[model samples]
Target chain A: MTDENIANHLKSLKKYTPARIGVGRTGTRPLTKDFLSFRTDHAAAVDAVYGEVSSKLIEELDLFSVETCYETKDHYLKRPDKGRILSEEAKTIIKEKCTPNPQVQIVVSDGLSASAIDENILDVYPALLDSLSMYGLNIGTPFFVKGGRVACMDDIGEILAPEAFILLIGERPGLVCAHSLSAYMCYQPKKGMKESDRMVISNIHRSGTPAIEAAAHMGTLISKMLDQKKSGVGLVI
Target chain B: MYKKTTLLGITYEFHSLKEIMAKANEEKSGDELAGISAENMKERMAARAVLAETTLSDIRSYPVVAPEKDDVSKLIEENVNEEIYGVIKNWTVADLREYILNDEHLSKELLQIGTGLTSEMIAAVTKIMSNLDLIQAASKITVITHCQTKIGQKGVLASRAQPNHPSDHLAGIRASLFEALSYGIGDAVIGINPVIDTTDNIYALLNETKEVIDRFDIPTQNCVLSHISSQMRAIEKGAPADMIFQSLAGTQTGNESFGISISMLEEATSLIFEKGTAEGQNRWYFETGQGSELSADAHFDVDQLTLESRCYGLAKHFNPFIVNTVVGFIGPEYLYDSKQVIRAGLEDHFMGKIHGLPMGVDVCYTNHMSADQNDMDNLSTLLSTAGVNFVIGVPMADDCMLNYQSLSFHDIATLRNVLGVSAAPEFADWLKKQGLTISSGQLTKQAGDPSFFL
Candidate 1:
């Protein structure tokens, strides 16, 4: 291809708008200060609500194995390669905190948006596990990833060899909501497995989707993946 | 209402609390007990008023500086002035917003700070109003970059001699991969050059990639390949390999280039599958075959491939194949109008059908507008509306360093909230729940936590 040819070829593709622009300025108003103050107050209120919910869930579910994992956003954002590898301490905790071997391994991560996990996991996780139990599958030791990515599944799969691996992680940060989460599942997940090798259940949140329904659906899909031995486009379901 | 009085107190020397209290008692206008309480309250109010006055004075000392576009040295100089005062009195917090909006130069400077107070507020507010849970769920998505090589027979050397270089094909691939990966999509299937030539060196390049495959342990079985020769050879054989492989390859590339022949690629895959079946081994198989040259009358017709055929062909080869196209650097003007190219390619190749694969647009970062939120949102929304899945480019240096290569969880949430779309939220939330974090300067873990989700 000539310079002209290459130039012409490039001339034909669509353009990309920055992700932030999709979220326009909130707007200017005489009550803008009041609105901002109110928002901050609401944030505090929500935090309190979620905190109470979390404690209740822990109590109601009889989950004595829960541990609080904390990390700074700065550390999580700078080291993606590090994100792919689990910390020794985390591994130790995982080994000690829950069952060792089971039919499947389920993990929850805060990913880039910790609020996502803090907000939705309490409801979604239990629903999913219940579905799994109904399918006669035993869940392995469940752990939390502080700053996770999709590739982290490979590391988790390598560390804990389960028949199926289900990872509920946060999505990339956007302008609108920071609490969304997705469940990615694969059979015998290993390093360098293309995304097509996995099945995803996405849009599981309160506003756009029902977390409970998504969990139940994810449960059904995982069972199907185990039975079919395929995912993505290959899985019949 | 009680009488109002203003008192100013300045001490030339420090006095003990007892002495101050005695003086306050001496000036009381009531009985001893009430006088003491009133004196204490007066002192307390006086202290608070003094502190507030000082703070206001300090803020007034420093002039508010506007943001710069290229050079931030001036803003820094002004910020230093503000710091010396221990408080910013003249500039209200609202002034910060004005500075960002009115002065592009200052905003660029602030971006250098990585995580400034303003950005943090923006990120936090954005996260709250947006439905982050949904963004995370849809995080794993596909981004396809569509392109078609200009019609002509040009050797690899000749193509390399041009400005884009090996970058032409690489650009398309990079854009598609970038878009897919940015959105947390793990796999990306790219379209091979439609006008395959005997002299092309891609085969050699693939051989080199073998090391990458082995080192990464990437499953090579899923990475399929198809060429004209492979298709033709499959057709000549009576085996069903020709139909399977030809159809698959055609479907994969049909969304990419109209010139791709799905039947040819499918035919080859079928032959290979049959060969594997005959051998009685469940081995990984990728079809290799050849295609008959088109007659003069049939040449144009042969070049046109349908979207359905392309999708089917790719589905046959790799179940969830990602179809991408190329958009070469035509010129600066083309930078602003890239959608025209994608529209034309879609019209020409798929006949305006939307494929399941993620579609994307790739361009040079040089042409990309710097630190323009409006531009970014416009571009993202346009692609999303057009059914484009992702965008690939050299994220702005500041953005990349800030680790904002793709949409941030906060940004994605904002998009969903504004557009009332669930996909963005689902995708973002899914990424976050996976514990995948994007920092400003690098892709790193958060503190002492493990990177993996186990």
Candidate 2:
């Protein structure tokens, strides 16, 4: 047969025809169904983990002062930029409720993916603080950054000017669970500083990374960053 | 609960213009009589002396002191001498020169001012001059760059031809092209050469380009064209090009080398010849597998490995056909970085492989280099040497597509068009044909039995 005739015949075939290829929709009825399922599963998982870690923190570490507590969706898809800046109410609450100039400030916020912070932050935060305390590093008032991007840490650093600022935020949501939080630490972060300049410990979640371990590592990284007066790729240790 | 914390900070102030000018006038008086333009020089010298004196007075008045970190101080710093007086004397003259040369409008208000010119007028003149310069420069130049592979005894030796890492190179090239085009470079063509073997590197290069687009600003509708070889095409298709082409051709000459079922080859040739012609300036994208051999001898055996080899051979043949009969040839060799592979395959005239092929490929390669320091320097040198015109690397890709990072398809298409490719319209039409179905947070392709190949 001629090339034209053959091409025509091949075009008639089902395989060659363009078709809807549903990517990232595996083992589910539809995308909406799969997404909902993922969200619910992640929320429950995060809640369970948080309950265990927070209880332990309260009982063993005597960590009772709660400045602010809030919840957001797992994917945080509805409010993507929410984590970047503190709300007016949140700012006011922080000013009134928490001590103004503690050696260090500790905050918890749902960042890129709320589920990440929900799943990882509790265990990570306490461990980080414990490590810092051991090093004789006094933390100032700590606050959570909800829906925070990496640059938000710079903003916080500007406001707090804590010898060093530690931000535990969720990494970008991936196919894996959304609750994978990352710890972004910087020494006096300011505007115009590139993201690479901020030190980060990503993948802090249950599946690939464990929270407590990541916290310990993050604490070490922060201490080194402070000691060297550098963060991100510039931090040697 | 959230609270507000007011962080204290300090700001610094600089000397005033009057003080600086006074100091300058004093300094210039000592050097007087050194110039031939006595009158004009005296005025200028006095101005300088006054500027210096003003600076001294301002410094004496303000004094330099380190501010306490937490202290509340005015954040605004005024450098009257540097910004106001210096700009008035230096920038105003520059603006007037530019205005006179370019014949651009000079504001009457600026002339009336005691100072040489107002800041607003200087800014306007500077903007106009810069834009004109950029336009003039862009119209006169076109750049060609490529990335390819060299086949080695062990494997493939990949290198990108640009000073920056492949991505940085792509970004820099795109930025330059966009700047040139925006400044009125008409029909600028950026040729790209890709080194195909492992998709990882190619995808990385594309991703780098994508990163450039994402991180920087570039004007739209700039021309960019890409020429990729068949082997590279096969890699993109995730299959061996020979088998795919054979299957598409409906060639039943099973397991025959160069046999290609004469009828199937003829039919394919006729179809391409009819659709792709020199008069119409039709653009054709060729696909093939990687190899350094080709033979018309029908007695050869055909297997997956051989099929892959033949794809490269097919590329050599198709390249000439496209270049001679069409607007351009998008050869993969230009993109491949492995010098040995390109040398063995194309540079050596497909040594021990295909012979008697037509010439004038008019192709550029794809480069994929990391943002790492070493790679950037190597890429810059390579691009400088190759004089590459265009490139095609991903700005982003879904996890399913080789690289987990995704790129903006719109930017890529626009870049290609800017590089002078007739294929851009067709590619854009194909994308639009996919329609508005969203899947996995991305547009889904439509299910249609459209007979385009026919």
Best by DockQ: 2
Please report, as a value between 0 and 1, the fraction of native contacts recovered by candidate 2.
0.01
Instruction: Note the clash tally of each candidate.
Output: 159, 144
TM-scores for all predictions:
0.32, 0.32
Badly placed stretches (over 4 Å) of model 2 are A1-83, A97-104, B1-454
**What is the per-residue lDDT of model 1 for residues A1-237, given as tens digits with 9 covering 90 to 100?**
454653443343212322111111121111345335423533442332122223444345444332222243333332344566666676666667666545688877655445666678878988888889889998887766655667777866766767788988765433234466788888887788877888887656687468878978888888987898766778887
TM-score of chain B only, all predictions? 0.30, 0.23
lDDT of 2 by residue, A2-67 (tens): 657645544343232111111122221124663454335434433432322234433343333221
Question: lDDT for model 1, on a 0 to 1 scale?
Answer: 0.36
- Report the Cα lDDT for residue A35, model 2: 40
Model 1 CA deviation exceeding 4 Å by range: A1-72, B1-454
Native-to-model Cα distance after best TM-score fit, residue A53 in candidate 2, in Å: 14
Q: Against the true structure, what is every candidate's RMSD?
A: 27.2, 24.9
Tens-place lDDT per residue, model 2, B1-454, is 1111121332212233322122222111111211211134344344333322232223223321111310101111121223334444433333443333442322232222212222222212222233233222222222111111011111111111111122324433443223222211211112223333244444444444334333432111111112222323323543211111231110122223333443444454444334321222122233232221111212112111222322323333232211111101111111123232222122211110111121111122211101121222233223212222222222111111121121112222232233332222222233334341222212232211122212
Top TM-score prediction, candidate number: 1
